[model samples]
Target: MKLSKPLIIGIAGGSGSGKTSVTNSIYEVFKEHSVVVIEQDFYYKDQSHLDFEERLLTNYDHPLAFDNKLLISHLRKLLVRQSVEKPIYDYTLHTRSEKSVLIEPKDVIILEGILVLEDEALRNLMDIKLFVDTDADLRIIRRILRDINERGRSIESVVEQYLSVVRPMHNQFIEPTKRYADIIIPEGGHNEVAIDLMVTKIKTILENGTELYYDDDINQ
Candidate 1:
């Protein structure tokens, strides 16, 4: 059944938190239906004007690093059931790629990012907000491995960046947004009980089109 309005779920967490795992869990359950995952990292500001060295100096974990105005516009279009050409970010170049992927409107839109809930406008657009609460040690370890293996970063560089930027930014920006979340998911995707309950809630909304409510128990 088609929803009267698409359900927008905002999943936010620290860089190494299992936000992707949580997003993928939800998407896998609804893959047969109309659902799409939009990553906030895909909206990083274009740095073509800057030289390679200058681009490398970018504080990626900061909120100002994103082109949220364009992201918000695109999200608005999707909310109206219009297609949008979503930007693709290039990690190697530290800027947005020229290529973009066209995304059609879906019944459920999962907006996942390190700071998806940081902006008031972005948070206002979400029907449900989730904060994945993973310990700092685990997060850093995961980040180091992911960056070295997937993003082609050196272990020394990853640790340096995490200590200098990621940790401070998380404390100042990302962690505070937890107060705005409808649910606080500890251990992220590893928490099977939370994921199962979240899936059930989404299915209920899709089937009934009922008003969404924040469950205090879910956060406990």
Candidate 2:
């Protein structure tokens, strides 16, 4: 079966703003449609080279921390109807695993991360851009839980990182990027209606074929 067009959708939010959850919801709806996920988290420079405190201080929220150039290059390939093996990242060790994920050109690619929309070059590749808006307090709580249990962080360290880095960085870079979003979804993954709306958009795109012809358009 020929994939008429590869719809690249970007989901952006601050730390623990449910970016991944929203992404998963989209995937649930469109899983059988042959969609691939390319996460921005995979681009973090290997932090394993550093010590524990140094890795904690490592600004995961910074746009400069990501390999945006490489991400843009991959998106370009996907846009031209090519497949890309996005890197896999592990937060537990603060480094990326050696193995690469092979992703085929599909009907849709749901790209999710904190700074997915931070770069104009990367943003331009998306057919739709969504910003997940959740309260700062709620985000912080989620961050604490995920970091402590999932990412192997301590309570004190999490608080310190939040106050010293995450909050400020979000205000400076991540939050400001919301203005660029084509749509803003409040409450993140819990917003089932919003998720449905996005799924509907993808269905509409497939039916319309207005943006799916990767072979025909160079600028798309």
- Name the TM-score of candidate 2: 0.90
Q: What TM-scores do the predictions have?
A: 0.93, 0.90
Give residue 57's error in model 2 in angstroms.
3.7
- Cα lDDT tens digits, model 2, 114-190, are 98888987886788999999999999999899889888879998998889888999999999999999999999989
Q: Candidate 1's residue-wise lDDT over 130-199, tens digit each? A: 9999999999989988998888789988989998999999999999999999999999989999999999
Task: Give the C-alpha lDDT of model 1.
Answer: 0.90
Residue ranges of candidate 1 with Cα displaced over 4 Å:
1-3, 210-220
Off by over 4 Å in 2: 1-4, 47-54, 213-220
lDDT of each: 0.90, 0.84
> Candidate 2, clashing residue pairs?
5-212
